[model samples]
Target chain A: MRYIKNPMEIEKTSFEIIGREMGEHNFTEAQLQIVKRVIHTTADFQYKDLLEISEGAIEAGKEALRNSPLIYTDTNMILSGINKRALGTLKGNAICYVNLEEVHKEAKEKSITRSMAAVEKACDENVDIFVFGNAPTALFKLRELIKEGKAKPKLIIAVPVGFVGASESKEGLEELNIPYITVRGRKGGSTVAASIVNALMYMIVER
Target chain B: MRYIKNPMEIEKTSFEIIGREMGEHNFTEAQLQIVKRVIHTTADFQYKDLLEISEGAIEAGKEALRNSPLIYTDTNMILSGINKRALGTLKGNAICYVNLEEVHKEAKEKSITRSMAAVEKACDENVDIFVFGNAPTALFKLRELIKEGKAKPKLIIAVPVGFVGASESKEGLEELNIPYITVRGRKGGSTVAASIVNALMYMIVER
Candidate 1:
């Protein structure tokens, strides 16, 4: 059978197929781009219904990207999967503190996960955008910090995946008065989180 | 609500929940571990039924890992996701050729993809274990080289994810006589591919 040999054509074809398969949707242009990119990454169409993009989340993310924000991710997988070239053009950088010595020491001392410790540490750095894709505890901690007025990220991309506290922690995002994008259930991962950021970067850089 | 705090305990609890939710299956002990890890990574239970492990595939993978063989992956995402510490313990290294200058030149010269060109270049290097997580074209090209008797990997983990050629390339693996592990449909990605390798390494190193 014939298929697209060029990488760019392959991705374009994949997006076309995703749009066709998704049929009708109420998502805005920005939301549709993020949803289509997530579906493209996983080949699972359920994301069409699962993704929740809060009001102004995409604009906030794009604005942050334009300012060369410090993008903090919960996992290195998300950091590695992000489009570095697009991010470089936008002057934004992605970082994960889960492997840091200070984060490890804090987790050990506080009897918390490295994910939680990393986010707690990140809160002090005035992170512009927060991306969580692995640990629900990190999301919960960030939520707590936000509620306490200790952390104030411009945009949050929370899609932590797991059996423990994943859905509940995401549901908690609804209570916060913050611009955020999240999956509605327990079906998200590092790829999904990174795809949202990449989609946002592509929106700005590619345009 | 209460939840796991320590990272090790969190992973242990997640696996226990997965085993409990998965209930009963026909997978062997090794196959079950691989499937559980995939499910853990994605929080998607579909992989329990979708994963296929040819006879001796896991054993072949473990044996190859033990020998410090070169693991060639189709994407840098997979390369970044693999457990570097465990692989270091085994003295093995993982490499992705998709971004190499020669691979890019070859793709442009031959009117093919960087993924396919990378695999073609790798065939000459005697790759021990081949892992394909992003490009179905790479998997197809590797299958072609193997059929031509130019490449003989000890084991192949083909789980490229996309709408085009993803399921077809994985289904094509059934036609080869080589030991392989794959997801039956288009529901796999870099994380799933890297999870299998990490699970195998954990089995050997953690034991």
Candidate 2:
């Protein structure tokens, strides 16, 4: 095992290696940052083929992010991983209502998952970004709300990882004709989702 | 998109599907629970191959859990995802030092990552379980401390996801000759680590 001189150095070297591994991409600079961060997190190169980025989605996401949009995630993991400083600079907030008492009660009453209930709650609010990285049901519920004209987001990041409804939910997302950055199959989680958001935030600051 | 009737039902169905996908294992009931939870989180059956559980590691982990062993994690995400009720019932506490003021200061002073500094801080505490799901540097630091006989954990869950030093750190852990549950490659994260711990806690309650 090689000795790690320092964390930053290791991270920088890793990013360099990832760029070499995933060379010759057609993605924009903004989108490339998000892709590299995802690849950096998972070390899975197959993401090149699985990831589907809608046309002009990165620019749209960057614009929404510059507005300090209120971000919502299906899981607390994604909420906590978000760069608070970046969000704070833009006066934006990241909220995860999965464990809220009201959400729990509503889910129980409605016979739905807490994640889906959380999305339903977001639907009523002025949410700018929707990120689902754990619960596919949440993405499915979000799709329904968008269809009914109850919710509209600048960009939807639907990358829930699991066997049950993961692939199916992303497939549903593909038919929405709305803007999204999603993995085509059952391979994603809060880490990847948060990385995507962080990449966008970093791009905003750097620009 | 399909509607989720309830969280419990969806989780039950997912577990059943996982069982069928990973048929006929020699794992004990507790081990099987951990395996199923990991598969359920990642939807990657290959985890069945990547995850390495040392002999009697589950029993050791169970003993620590029953004793309310102090839990330490590399990320806030893992800390937030743990079964707090189970830990509370056992009079245990989950601690994440990465965000601590002292950790940040010390890491800067020592020119290391906050995660590695957190491991140094944890090495001084009365910790029983070391869960590293995000930072391989933390895992490597822990391995160093253990080699110097400064720290001893009842069980180490060393599954950090990344390209940098991730696999090498787990490989470093294998030579420690300590009881551990680790994934051999770069296919793990805070979610998977937290799921493994939750599976252990649930098995404890179920039994």
Candidate 3:
């Protein structure tokens, strides 16, 4: 008949439950924060095993956050899920070009997804961080851009969720010689992607 | 290296994959649409067994959509994920009061969550449909309001995702003699909740 009513208490208790359920893991402090936040956003504890963080990936993400880096997301949902108030403290902004007129025109011309076109458009900008949540093609395109030496993001958070090419695109990201974090399967979403960014922001800003 | 590039084709292919993987189901035509869309958004097939829809729930939702309902959401992420173009065709609008000043004041005043406060504020509005995605407290509060005869909605899509009170709140909804659709456990999110609305809109508007 009763439960935690305060927002902070609810979040605190949720995290506590996550910590208790997860028990012990080999994740570093920063990686644990990202994993915990992801698991908190999604009640699935499988993220503990599915999430793969490259060596120093958290450090790279945190360093980029310290700078006023531009965070590019594949979907507006991810852009909406991000902690804007936290990003604002560091003078950073989250952007989603999927709905842009130029991106739409390019997608139609190339017969590609707007997600892919948006990533292509982002290649021209000074994007320091890339977050792909909805489209595998977007992650694949970003990997292609990186392979051609056109884009050099400090950190990439790729967790495109779907049955088609989601796992393969993340595998492509894992093969890249870049600092990145990704789920190893078809079990991630905008909420998980945004939670990672929020965890990174909270590490630097809220600390 | 090549895949479905056209956005419509990609969606069509994705739905085909879902249908193929799901094999056979006993869902009605309307229920199948909602289930397929949820599975499309989340690659998890457990939804096949997890989703619970009351009799005539889809009809209730469709009827509300036909009347230009004010769709109330618990989070901005869900409000952003909804297909605005489709909803616009029906003269329906999705609104989230989580960030409203009045809702914040009420939450602080009542010592409840902002999600619960937002639902309380929505109780005064002419809300035709209710969608709860991220907060179980909101669902519990709505169930309370309904129990007291304070509010009634044509259709309630309650799928609050978390480990805390998510399942219990949904169980509360099931106990009420109302037309509602919900995920049985802690396996739904804003994406799932928004996809249901989009599927319903697509059914009426695009068809």
Segments of candidate 2 deviating more than 4 angstroms: A23-25, B23-26, B172-174
| Global lDDT scores for all candidate models | 0.90, 0.85, 0.89
Question: What is candidate 1's lDDT per residue for A1-207, written digit by digit as tens?
Answer: 466787788889889989988999999888899999999999988999999999999999889999988999998889989988898888887889999999999999999999999999899999999999888999989998999999999999999898888888899675788899999888898999999999999998973
Give one digit per residue, the lDDT tens place, for model 2 in B108-161. 998888998999999899699999998988888898899999999999999998
* Candidate 3: tens digits of C-alpha lDDT, residues A1-207: 587687777778888889999978998878888999998887888899999999889999999999998999999999999988899999998899999999889998888899999998888997999999889999889888988899999999999998778878888565677899999988898888999999999998963
lDDT of 2 by residue, A89-189 (tens): 87788999999999999988888898989999998887999999989888888989888888889899989997778888888565666789999888888
lDDT value, residue B43 of candidate 2:
72
Candidate 1 vs candidate 2: the TM-score winner is 1
lDDT measured at residue A56 in model 2 versus the true structure, 0 to 100: 74
Residue B164 in candidate 1, Cα distance off native in Å: 0.9
Write down the DockQ of candidate 3.
0.70
Candidate 2 backbone collisions, by pair? none
Give the per-residue lDDT of model 3 (tens digit) for B101-191. Answer: 9988989888889999999889899699999989989998898998999888999999988878888888857567889999998878899
Check candidate 1 and list the clashing pairs: none
Question: Candidates' DockQ values?
Answer: 0.77, 0.69, 0.70
Q: Which stretches of candidate 1 lie over 4 Å from their true place?
A: none
